[model samples]
Target: MLLNPLLSLSRSPSVLQRPSSLLRPLSSSNLPPIQGGSSSPSLYCRSLVQRLDHDAFLTSYFWPAGRKKDAFFALRAFNIELASIQETVSNPAIGRMRLQFWRDAVRDLSNGLPPPLHPIPLLLSQTTTPSTRDLTAYYLNQIIDAREANLLDPPPPTLTSLLTTLSTTSTPLHLLSLSLLTPTPPAYITSSVQHLSLSIGLTNLLRALPFHLSRRRAVGLPLDLCAKERVVMEKVFRIASGKEGGEGGLSQVKGLREVVWEVAVRANDELMTARRELELEGGTGFPVGKEFMPVFLSAIPARSYLQRLEQLDGDAFDPSLQRRHWRVPLDVWLAWRRGRF
Candidate 1:
């Protein structure tokens, strides 16, 4: 999943200044050394998550501190690393080699063997104890397998294909996060988490479009939607490359807004379904446990980003979309206070 650059801690000093012990200074000296060093894996995890996935780092503050929180960071760090493989490696075989390492790592972690000298796996080994079984090899391997499958695979041909990619890549994250908080979350919670995962996954794909285009990777947007909307991929690349710009610049690209609108609408539908699931489970007065709210809080950023995109009339290329919404932290805090996501 692509991270929204808007919620980055580097861009928002006000978010960084929030008074919480969980918010550590994002300086290297304060974080632990990398893998194989004698340092707390939690610190390494926290540092890695903050640097690579700031939104995850920001949402992670909602999780209770200690082992549960640390486990959440470890899981996010693992995901961030895997998500980053496409950008890091030039060759598909090299990416597979890396994925193979993680596959072996997960297998070892589940078998109670000494994990390889990696901070994320080591931290996971310590927190996901056999007694608790909080994190499972099944979920970890699902994520790796999906990432491996995506290595040389072409862009999704349809929306169904896109959701299938998310079902494995994103769904497992929510399940694993919920498991860290409670061994068995209510069925409603599980269902809602699944919906939220897809919602966020779609939103992230939109947010990352600019970044992907810069690298000539037109992967997240489905081929069917592009065909239906007459969205010329070459035109999109020219616009992104600044080769097609003047007055009425982005508008020159045909059917792009329609494609964006379709994607955003799907994201909103998933988000609303998640909310409706919660309401149906307990009516309007459902009791939101503190333990459960952290998982729900992730919805705040996704909802906020989607709302802002809608305000711009689904203009994905709008420069305003790149900046952090000043109210996000306040919105998150207010949602937390009201016992809602």
Candidate 2:
């Protein structure tokens, strides 16, 4: 979900600019204690590290143990922080500025500067292997590319065009990162990441559709194209509902709620297909495909959330305030992680 002003206020620019706000006084003295000489870590940096550590512990069990696990955790943390900054900034311009800060930080890392006091950079520096520095730089560039893509409205129709737009953004870099984490690069890594990112973008687009349709808004996407996409999506939803299977006595309620499930199933299918293609392409020696398994499993939680919504709202299928319906993807992510799927 996009950050509103209220959410962004929690991490206001003023707070970010003030180093004092970021650090706690060690002794009740007016003078702040310095660590590593002119490189005292910020509270935000510490907190971010802690959060990353926690998330890593929870998710990294799936990863092979040792340095590989550590590297995977670090990369995952960096990606989370990068994505979070965009979602947390209240103003788009400020978000862009934060992203640029990241770009500079990445460049600085290449120069052997102690990681920036900022958590993301610090974590990235810690995880970066000498061999992977170039890959790191490339990945950082991808984040910048994604931010740039976000600034523009949705591009014109055609899957080719959309894929092109996505290629320039975070998707390909994410695929590359997945490739790096594995013992071997899988051919399907690119397709899987592409499909996953697109699935996420499409779901996000769906959530925003009602508002766009009602307001006649055309932010980065043409209304006609959006309409067409929605129609396809609706078909996708029906398939999810199992109505297309010709199973009689399937409750209409199931059909109504199938939109959420359909998205998940389609995303899973894309991921599986990508994995198969990668294996067929002689990329089977690497763990690249396995890296994306968790991401694909994320859909289970999304479907669960939809079920909860159906029970609670009962009228969740109605065409009203779709924006209000967005929830924490993490909730679904956690649930899926716990085998709740």
Best prediction by lDDT: 1
With a 3 Å backbone cut-off (N, CA, C), the pairs that clash in candidate 2 are: 22-43, 153-220, 154-220, 184-286, 188-278
Whole-model lDDT, model 2: 0.45
Query: What C-alpha lDDT, on a 0 to 100 scale, does residue 209 get in candidate 1?
Result: 68
CA-lDDT, candidates in order: 0.76, 0.45
Predicted structure with the largest TM-score when compared to the true one: 1
- Output the worst ten-in-a-row residue range by lDDT, candidate 1: 15-24
| Candidate 1 structure quality by residue, lDDT tens digits, 17-39 | 11111112223342334443326
Model 1 clash number: 0
Worst 10 residues of 2 by lDDT: 14-23
TM-score of each: 0.87, 0.53
For model 1 the local lDDT of residue 307 reads 94
* Residue 67, candidate 2: alpha-carbon lDDT: 52
